[model samples]
Target: MAKVNISLDAELVVEVMVLAGVGSPQDAVEAVVRDYIARGHRTEARTELTEQSLREVEATPQEPQG
Candidate 1:
């Protein structure tokens, strides 16, 4: 795997480590990034339009007003 080094605030890194329950700052940041990506994928899956869904919507009958 390729690695890149970036600068971050010491306090921010410590906070991330504490929140993520990770022993190292790198692991904490990596975990957070992975979680963010997974969340994006989940959101995309939920909002994606499908051919079946479109057909179902089109087949629904409208009710007449009382």
Candidate 2:
């Protein structure tokens, strides 16, 4: 865990706490940061899978219908 001193808007912190259902400002901030990081990982994984599938399709030979 890391600790840092920073300033934040009281109203915004309260709103985030309420929306996130967290009791502490620290918890709310941590939850939002974790969620943001997880979203990026998911997006990267999806992009990699899509590229691999496209490559496989391109490499496979097509059959002609008479």
Candidate 3:
């Protein structure tokens, strides 16, 4: 296993530990690694950014409704 040194917010770490039923920070980190490797995360970011730009171009100024 590749060893990585990273930091997590204390609250978030606790939350993930409780939900995941993991015993230690390493376990939580490993879970994240497994999930991240299995599911690539970047494609959606690009897609969302593209959609937002398109919406900005297409959005028309709306008249305030009474």
- The candidate maximizing TM-score is 2
lDDT of 2: 0.94
| Model 3: lowest-lDDT 10 consecutive positions | 37-46
The TM-score values for the models, in the order shown, are 0.74, 0.81, 0.50
Clashing pairs in 1: none
The segments of candidate 2 whose C-alpha lies over 4 angstroms from its true place after superposition are 63-66
**How high is the CA lDDT of each candidate model?**
0.90, 0.94, 0.82
Q: On residues 1-66, what C-alpha lDDT tens digit does candidate 2 reach at each position? A: 778877899998899899999999999988988999999999999999999999999999999979
RMSD of each: 3.3, 2.0, 7.5
Q: Find the number of clashing residue pairs for candidate 3.
A: 0
lDDT of 1: 0.90
Candidate 3 versus the native: TM-score? 0.50
**Which candidate comes out best when scored by lDDT?**
2
RMSD of 1: 3.3
